[model samples]
Each structure stands twice: as C-alpha cells, then as structure tokens.
Target: MAREVFDLSFSNGFARTLHERALGDIEQDYPWQSLEPSRYPPLLLARARVGWTENAFNEFCTAAAMGQMLQALVQARAPLDLIGMASRFAIDEVLHIELCARMAMRLGGGAPIHYDPEDIVFALDPSLTPLERSNELVVRLCCVGEALSFPLLSGAMRSASHPLSRSILETIVRDEAHHGKFGFLYLDWIRAELRPAERDRLGKAARQTLDAYRSLWERGPSHVVAGVTSEGFLLEHVRELGWMEASAYAELARVTIEESVRAPLARAGIML
Candidate 1:
C-alpha cells in the first residue's frame, strides 16, 4: 500500500550527488574578485563596525533556524539521502555563523545575538500540516532567504572596502548557492506529487511568503554602524538591479519562487 512507504535511504544517492555538486559549485562561483570596493561610505567605518556585529547576530539566528529544520526533517523520516545532505547543510550554516562572527570582530565590534529562539525557529504558522510545513520551510528558508541573499551579498561584496569583508561575502555567496539549490530540488520533487488544488494553495502561499520577504528586506533593521543610514543608498542600488519597480520585482520574486518551488510542486500534481 501507498508505494510501500518508500525507504528514506532510497533518496540517499540523490542527496549525495546534490551535496557534492553543491560543494563544487561554491568553489567555482567565488565572487570576491569581481567585486569592486569603491562604492562604500568612506567616513562610516564605525558604522561598518557595528553593522558587521548586527550581521553576525542575524547570521547566527539563521543558522540556528536551519539546524532546527534539518533536525525536524530527519526525525520525520525524510529520505536518508536528503537527510544526509541536510546534515551537511546544518554544519555549513553553523560555520556560516562562526564566519560571520569573525567578520564582525574584524570589523571591530561584537553585537550580541538578542533574538528570541522561538522567534527564530518556530516562526511558521502552527496550523500547517507536515507537507505544508515542508513547503513553507523550503520557500521561506531556501527560496526567499537564500535567493534574496544572493543579490544582497553581491552588493555587499562589491561595496566591501576591506579584504576580509570581501572574502567573507565571497565564501557566503558560494555556500548560499548550494542552499538555494536544495529549495529548487525539493520544490521540483514536491510539485510532481501534488494535486491541482494543492498547487494553487502553494502558489498563494508562495506569493504571501515573497511579499513578506520583500517587506523584511525593505524594513528590517539596517547594519549601518557608523551612525549613517544606508537604507536609501542600498535601496537605490537594489532599484538599479531592477528590484525597485513593483511590477518587475514582483515578477522576479514570482519567477524565483516558481522555479524553485511551484514548478516542482506542479510536477508532483500539488495544487497551486
């Protein structure tokens, strides 16, 4: 019955292949060299110093959340291959926290991570089913979180004046690409399994998440440590990258979520 409850191990090969590819991809996509350091504020070194601390705290929160999600997936009897790959991802995220901390230190400040653990880990809707939970996790954490990070980190890399900062952003970008790929693959897999109604539900869910992500990016606390607000400048740059036009940005957000989540859900016959 029910396809004999497919063994978690059955997905191991796929997970391993994807994991190894992730490593290779990161190595190949290093972005430090392409970044120019001349765009940052010259006088706000102090703010930069504080910003890095805030960044490190935020990264720590991210890593903790990822770790919890991975643990949940494993406990839910997810494919061993997927679990294994996620295990590695958990480790990678932990390292990311450490790396961000070091970067903050290099920038000359240490902002303590003050977020409530509940706020970071159980931030999702409690009413969702396991499948919905999984969908939400992949969309929020992988697609929106990591996807948005790509452009943000790229801008940061380009604006970094210090060598360490440049290297840190480069390393992060490489790892994040792999993390984003996980969302892509999982969405693909789920799409093939969902019904039409489920697919529609997913589409609505995805749109809501994207809107939330946009709001977070636009209004979230800034990292400007030197008493200078970089929000206007940062938003200006993002606009230059085509993220300012409501229609265009919405399309990009939809495309990104669809490519990583919806298409896969569709393939699986999931509604929305």
Candidate 2:
C-alpha cells in the first residue's frame, strides 16, 4: 500500500455494528503452552522472519479488500442480510490481522506493516454499475481468494508439526470457510441484478483470479517450493523444520484451484 490505510475508529455506524456483533462471541486464542519457537532451526526461523512477514502482508491485503467490499455493498444498495454479511466479513479480516501479526511474533517477528488506505479498497471502475463493480471484487477476493484459502490452510494445518501452529492454522481455516461462502451468497443474492455482459466480465475476472492465485503457488515467493528446495541451505532448513514437502505443498494448491475454485465457480455460472 502507498500511504493511506483504514482507521476503524472513524468507521460508519453500520461498519462499527458489524465489527461489534461479529466479535461479540469471539475470544482470542493462542497456543502459548504449546509454543517452542526456540527449538526451530535456522531455515524455519528464516521462514519465520520472511514467511511471517509475507503472511502479515497478505492479511493486510485481506483487510483492505474487506473494506472495499463494505463500500461496494452500500453502493450496490444490497439487502440487510447481505449488508450484515459484508460488515461481518470486514471484522473477520481485522481479527485475522491480529492473529497473523501475533503468529509472526511467535515466529520471531517480521517486517513492519505499511499500507495506503487508498490502495486498500478498489477504485471505481467506470465501465460497470455499482453492483457489478462490487460483484467483480467479491468474485476475486471472496470467491477465488477466500474460497481457495480454505483447502490451502487446511493442508498447511495438516502439514504443521507444531501444536501451536496447528491451532492457529485451524482457527484460520474455521474463519475462512464462512468468508469463502460469503462470495457465493452475495453472488446468489444479486444474480438478478447483473446483466449478461456483467456476468461475462465476472467470469473472465474469476478465470484471471484463478490464474493469478495459481501463479502464486507455482511462483509466488512464499508458496513456491522450487525456489528453496532446488538444492541449497533453504532446502535443508525446510526439511529440518519438518514443513510439508514442496511437491506436496504445490500439489495441494493446484488441486484446490481446480476442484474448489474452478468447479464451484462453474456451478455458480461464473465459468472459469
């Protein structure tokens, strides 16, 4: 992000309500008793320094994406239930920020987060209606991003050797399931409002999003396995941490994209 970023203190009443209600039943969870951060070798420690920083960055982006969705919801003149969902999703992202940030601390801390609020939300795309614009972003962020996140996180949880890491990953997987559904719900509710051309645009966008996320797995710094595992200190480091093998990790991402993202999107008429 450039410079501007969100400030919850200044949020509108509706946004505030969503935050309060969603967090009302929630309590922070940390596996303090299970943590053994010091036992991790240098590679996993580097994973901590670099990996946690990347996690924090993604969380920051998630928060901004949610903020954008909230604005789009209001502009789209959505019904109450969907609006409430949008509000709740915003809160979810904020909590995730806290969770990820602390996880980084547990991993031995990471780079400081910096973001521009302007960069957080989507800029208005003049070619589409308010509703269509909202749908497009939801398709990318919630539909593709959050939807795929579930399986990816679940795989990570399964691969995690540490109890505390599993706990944290589990919590994230739990939260992300709902977020993944939020896109489908929003799209379902507003299908009638969308033009055929708009749906095509969304379909195209969804495909692009799939490709983008797949690229991350195949090539993105954090998810890519080949970069570190091709033969070097990083490879030895990863093995010592008992982290999932790169082949396994990359395969998990690929399968999730094909089945979880592509198939479900086809069912939703957002064919990718």
Candidate 3:
C-alpha cells in the first residue's frame, strides 16, 4: 500500500460555521502569545512538533473509532442516552484533533508523517452479534485506551510549566474525563446479559488494545527526544513544551494500566 501524508483541514462557509458553533469559541483567550518557542533548542522544538502531530493523528483515529462505536450502539438498540453521549464525544475528538494540530504549528510546524489511509482504526469484527460487538468496541476504545490516556495526560499537564501548554492539556483532560469511565458505565448497564465466555473474549480484546499502546511507549526513545542522560535535566524545557520524559512517561503508563485499567476491568468482569 502506498503511504500517504497525514494531514488535516477544514471546510469554509456554512460547514465551518456549523463546526464553530459546535466547538464554541475554541481558540479564544488561549494564552497563545505566551509561547516562548525561542527558548528551546531547534531539535527539541522539532520533536515537540512531531509529538503534537502524532497526537493530532491519534485524535483523528479516535474520532473515527467513536463513529464506529456510536453506530454499533445504535444498531444494538442501546439506550437513547448512551447514543446521545457517543454523538457528543465524536465532536469532542474533532476539537481535540484541531487543538493538537494547532499546537504542532505553534512549535514550528507539524512534522511529516506517512500512513496507510486504509488502515486508520481496528475494524470491528463482523462475525459477532451486535451487542457483543458493542461490548468489544467499548472495552478496547474506552476501557483500555481512554482510561490509560486520562492520567497520562494529567501527568503531562502537571509537568507543563508553560501556560499555553498547560492550558491545552487541561482542556483535553476535561473533555476526556467521561471517556475513561464510559466503558464501566456501559458494562454496568449491560453486564447482566453478558455470558462468561463473552466476558473472557472482551478481556482479551482489552489486552490487545493495551498491548498496542504499550508497544508505542516502549519503542525505545523517540528519535528527536532519544537520549535520556542519568540526570535527564536537559529535557526540562521540553517538558514545559508539553512532553513527559521517556522514563516518566513509561512509569505513568504502568501506573495507569494497573490502577485505572486493570482494576476497573476486573470489577466489570473482564479481567485481563
């Protein structure tokens, strides 16, 4: 498959107007002018740009996944309230994508990334029943993925010294607060109908998603932020620019997986 450039854009006229209304004053008073890009080394800025670009791409993928979840819920005849909540989350992800992309531009410019457009997300298995498929989707996307991200984002937010960086992380964390718990809430509503075998399968699915994320953080160090000396003091400015050090990032990943993901998943009867 040919790799295509990963990029983002928006339409003009009424479409954009409608998007703005849904987003609601997204860029207003964001402390954008406070960014001191000059203080960081060029290499660090370039890395930050790539990091944010990766964030934007991941958000786009999540939005696509949300669409799949929303459709699955509706097909399964889920409660109207759950469907409505999923609808809202899809838009929230779009806003996040824009925010992350803009942050990349703020650092310098978004780094070039190539991806197979055909493979944006893990496709829902068609062999399963509607409700069963919904369960798998929720477990993977919300129970594991979003649950893992919430605390990691919080850690980055805490480490961010730059006001603009902190503000962006704060906004993302706020929007995603519900996402982390969405899986458990769905399970609470639907668990009575789930059989032991189905629960076991969902647990495996959750583990697959968890392992996917693990592979990312464990892929050694990023080329741009590769070296982490014993002191690790040189990356302090980079952290203010909205990145955790490699070690701190991996540690937090472990913490969130244990406390946030595994604990709740076991309670929900999908132990992994």
Off by over 4 Å in 3: 216-233
Better of 1 and 2 by TM-score: 2
lDDT of 2 by residue, 1-272 (tens): 36643222326689767765765523344565456567656665766656656665677778778888888888988888888877877666666665666666666766555566566555656877778778888898888999898888777777776656666677777888988888888878877777677778888888877776665468433443554655343553453333556667778888888888888777777677
- Model 2 TM-score, all chains together: 0.78
Clashes of each: 27, 4, 0
Compared with the true structure, what per-residue lDDT tens digits does model 1 show for residues 148-252? 666556555665544555676767777777776777677665656666665676566656656665643344334433432354345433322212323333454
Q: Candidate 3, clashing residue pairs?
A: none
TM-score of every candidate relative to the true structure: 0.62, 0.78, 0.92
Q: What's model 3's lDDT at 14? A: 96
**TM-score, model 1 to reference:** 0.62
Give the per-residue lDDT of model 3 (tens digit) for 156-263: 998888889898899899989888778788988998888999989998999888988876457464433344434343666867888777667877888889999999
Record all residue pairs in model 2 with backbone atoms less than 3 Å apart, i.e. clashing: 3-116, 4-116, 4-117, 5-117
Top lDDT hit: 3
Off by over 4 Å in 1: 1-43, 125-127, 158-161, 215-272
**Shift in Å, residue 236, candidate 1:** 17
